[model samples]
Target chain A: MARNRVGVIGGGQLARMMIPPAVELGIDLRVLEEAEGMSADLAATGVGDYRDLDTVLAFAETVDVVTFDHEHVPPAILRELVGRGIPVHPGPDALLYAQDKLQMRAKLSELGLPVPDWAAVESADELGVFLADHGGRAVVKTARGGYDGKGVRVVTEASGADDWFLALAEDGHGGALLVEELVDFRRELAQLVARRPSGEVAAWPVVETVQRDGVCAEVIAPAPGAAGRVAQASADIARRVAEGLGVTGVLAVELFETTDDRVLINELAMRPHNSGHWSIEGAVTGQFEQHLRAVLDLPLGSTAPREDWSVMVNILGGPAEGTLQDRYPAALAAHPEAKFHGYGKAPRPGRKVGHVTVGGDDLDDVVYRARAAAAFFEG
Target chain B: MARNRVGVIGGGQLARMMIPPAVELGIDLRVLEEAEGMSADLAATGVGDYRDLDTVLAFAETVDVVTFDHEHVPPAILRELVGRGIPVHPGPDALLYAQDKLQMRAKLSELGLPVPDWAAVESADELGVFLADHGGRAVVKTARGGYDGKGVRVVTEASGADDWFLALAEDGHGGALLVEELVDFRRELAQLVARRPSGEVAAWPVVETVQRDGVCAEVIAPAPGAAGRVAQASADIARRVAEGLGVTGVLAVELFETTDDRVLINELAMRPHNSGHWSIEGAVTGQFEQHLRAVLDLPLGSTAPREDWSVMVNILGGPAEGTLQDRYPAALAAHPEAKFHGYGKAPRPGRKVGHVTVGGDDLDDVVYRARAAAAFFEG
Candidate 1:
């Protein structure tokens, strides 16, 4: 049989994790990394900028299907690939919602999904009107190019966004901002789902994501204390989002778990997200593997939990302590059951260089093990 | 911390499987493959004949620790590297036992471990004596360089071995043959263990390996009907062998489960063996990962079974059918829970090109699913 060649347009950690599964399935993966020595360099890779249409098309020429490691590929480039008959999963139409916050908010709202009260704001005056109508406090965001708490800010008054508003007007950018009322909630959670071109969909357990300074720190699978209705609701919402957007890959819907027992859409990531990293060791089928299957239009794998509880703690790089390898001997011996994964990247302060996952029948024990193993890397 | 650079001396599927774990542990792996584009070619590989001292030594100089994907590395070459202060786990002293059948037999017998009755044979007369003591039938094996049923034969009479004895006498090969009484066993089993230089040992459940035409075709973990004393006996035997030989790596001890319930030692392999491939998806720590840990002298991962039953079925290539990749679309669609792995090798009849693993609470279901998925590739 001919091998299915899948071209990935970004060579970050997400693409790195996808290699094992692609190898397992006998698929040839060709990656266009941003540089010569990126995370997914282990695979057959070509170094080129995805924003350069000719560079991306050259990389796409070697593969049967195309997907993304990040959603930064410009819409025009993606549409051009589709127009030229290259099968890009989560096609331009679906990926545009992930690239532009305003588009995503408008689309999800139109789908009757429960999203925070929000609107597109062109200037500080428009933001002021929306903030006053709510509670004089709002969360303001640039419509594009935001991640890991960047390009986002919470402002109590319109004046707080003057700098951003001026910059947008100076660049002749119209309606370049998305604003929403400040969400007061108990905690944050993430629901991950995978959909294929054949309309097959699978959802993993909803996970509670603990955020520190807007960066995901830890994730507890199935969201402790969220059995029955809450878990079901999260899964249903994620499934709807996947189906609504025609997302032919993994879709991660970050949600606000309001104290009043409501779940509202907060953000969307149309690729394997950090919240589902626990699935690599804790679930029957990991998000990376499922994403590949979905994009290839192969049948999706089971999403059942492998244990009663699973926890994943991110190993945020610390101030140039030592290489992660130096910490391996102790961390490995300390928790033999914890599964650690390093992204093969140089460490930098607060960067996610690796993660640890632990699964068992005891929730507290797994959580502690995952956290302790991650802490060892942080040093 | 600095990353540990490991140099693997062979580039078959065993080494291919080690790359994922090495990447996860933040270690760099360098492989000396026998040929260009062999399995494990994706990793940083140098193509050269490992038997050449200069070639092997050149590859050795680039890494911190040296290990093997196959046991064919000459002991003298290993010793030469060790003499130069390069750490070679399963150092030449320990590797010698695996390299020569007679050496392994003598050592295990001296250790008082249960082994088949055997003796060295240099001539037809010696073979006759061995046969006479064992109902005139015995198994004869070449002392070195035998694998996968090669260099082995069944003899009932002196004349049946005349040609071999003549060759040995002409070559002045002293005691070049190992003979053993034909075993009267109901089935074959394998016990896998990993040991580190730090002296930590971990054993996985004994597994029943099914052989077809003298090649391993399937493996069932926690061998059905094997528990309590029988299971403990197998694990203990494997553990004793690893420690006794000072084998600092993953060791596979093949055994004959006698009809009367005793387990006898049959053969040994000092690297990741096919019998333990089920561990990739079935056990908490896969043999490939454990092998790397053991060789690096790092603390090993847990060897606990993740499911009640796990089955692995080898996908042997058939008569010039299609590539394994051709069958993936159907096989994967039919069995979503089965984990498939391909070695990226060009297929030849009866060659083990890939394998499928499935684990669940029910043994019958998991076994059937694994077999069905494997059969798809065979076609």
Candidate 2:
């Protein structure tokens, strides 16, 4: 008879989307938001720094389980919650792979997963050897605190990353740099899966994701022309990663389809990722709702597709010509079937403000409508 | 661009359900909730009396348009808002029919809509004459403040309603009683429609609703065995009512399938109704979202069914054995495809706390799953 309260750290759009489903499932969701007027402020939000042990511990004490909106929280903080016997989903051990690139690459390779050729580089000399061993060019990235094209660079020469190596050496953060062979992929795809503490797993149809400048812009469900074998392989890879890492919530595995038709893992997100936003309107049970059920250790819902095709287009901040409300009339009239989702956030250029999803029997029509609807909000 | 602010009065489950759609449409929805910790307290809620002109006017001044979660707000208060030039959806001119049954009967008759044989009675003598002209039996009802099964009676003789007639005469509220011939109908049906001020209207497929003690217990979308002619008739009747009344939001028309194979109007509601709750998971767009679009004069979304069948069963409060969260695991495990919606209210016997909807290719299977899932929460 006691309430099943789930505490979420880092209030963002992900936490906001979880509210409806959490209400439906009769779960009391309390959020530890970063500040006043954050995306999920509609719920019982506590303003505090997620990295502070006392702040997180206070938030953790109020709920039956603890989860997160992002992976930015340090592993030490998460371990502290575990040390207090608070149930933390995607425990610090599993989340470390998402937070640190070098750890993810080493761990995935140890498990024999298909990852691009990669290595840890502590100095300009190490970067030179890794680049030369591949194609004389590599993508170098910081091990942690990098997102949306930040803390990343393409280096053809060792000196290109000499400044980063020096900064890492000065900071004294061991295992700070990692490099990977620049991949020539034909397209990008994503596999979404949810796992529970009981070890039950559910995988949704693999979707094709489009990126512009390292930010996800669009997604097409049940990737067009993707062979059945390819879909099966993608699901298998995501399932293996979720189970092997002991992930107890939603996991997103970004993949690349090389020109030779091989699927290789690109990156990993341990929470509800942007790639699965289309599922909110296209799937039988949306990824947000599934995340709540999984974190609570309840039975997972079906991940079956509700339509033959579904397309999602992100609404990024544009020239600030108008607010989203100004475009609702035209956008809604243009595509009556498009479902628009706006995060209650102030718009900033190139920032993700909302998304539009359209599903139907035809792929092209759905994609066109979704794109057109999103365009209105951008302008 | 300026934000579109919608002010809603009388916070309840209907307002609670509207929150998701309002958020999606990028509109700032502020609710004048009746009390703290009400169903829609999670939204931007202001506590006040909806009946007080000053309280209502103060709330009205902050929004662009005004609507209601219930129709109990006095017409004078609505007229006062209109006097101030604030757009009130289902304005006083139209909401009168929903507040008074006698007025609704007279108006529907004038519009040539099919309603039962009825007449107003000021005293027991008039009731006797009406009953004698009929089959020696009639149904009596108060003109206002009636809901569910309250303020209604089946009287076979004049003396059976003597007390009510005497009270009506003494109160000085003239013609407080109306009598209609007892209707012999085969079943009940409901038609849901949304209309914008631009004269655009969208109607969902007619549904059959089951009632227990005048409370809606279940609903079946695209009602099985309903002839095409009957479905069209229901939609036409509902559309005519919406247009004729100048309704600016969702309208629900409860009807009776007479033994002579005809649809007759039974009741009218000017806002989201229980019979259309199935649309939340069954149709391309839900009644809540459609209502927002209509009130905003935005283009309405498609009302096409997402599947061949959808069944919704209300979770009426039974013996309060446990909280809804305690039953979620068993219910979700048993029916993974069923979508549950809880109103976040304390459960009491016969009160509507939540509902479960299931959509699929098979009617019997969907119905079974829906009923079973609802039953789990009831106990």
lDDT by residue for model 2 over A179-276, one digit each (tens)? 99898899999999999989999999999999998899999998998749889999999999998888889999999989888899999999999999
Weakest lDDT window of 10 consecutive positions for candidate 2 chain A: A318-327
TM (B chain), model 2: 0.97
Measured with C-alpha atoms, the lDDT of residue A378 in candidate 1 is: 71
TM-score of each: 0.97, 0.97
Residue pairs clashing in model 2 are none
Candidate 2 is graded, for docking, as medium
Candidate 1 per-residue C-alpha lDDT over A1-379 given as tens digits, one digit per residue, 9 for 90 to 100: 4537888989899999888777666677788999987888888469988999999999888898999999999999999999999999999999999999999999999899999999988777898999999889999999988999998999998888888888887888545689998899999999999999989999998999999888999999989988888888988999999988888899999999998899999999999999999998788899998998888888789898988999999988742676788788888999899898888888998898999999899888888888888888775
State the lDDT at B105 in candidate 2: 94
Q: Candidate 1 - CAPRI tier?
A: medium
All DockQ scores:
0.69, 0.70
Worst 10 residues of 1 chain B by lDDT: B318-327
Q: A192, model 2: CA deviation in Å? A: 0.8
lDDT of 1 by residue, B4-85 (tens): 8989999898888888787776678889999988888877468899899999999999999999988988888999999999
What are the runs in model 1 whose C-alpha is more than 4 Å off?
A: A1-3, B1-3, B169-175, B318-320
**TM-score, model 1 to reference:** 0.97
Total clashing residue pairs per candidate?
Answer: 4, 0
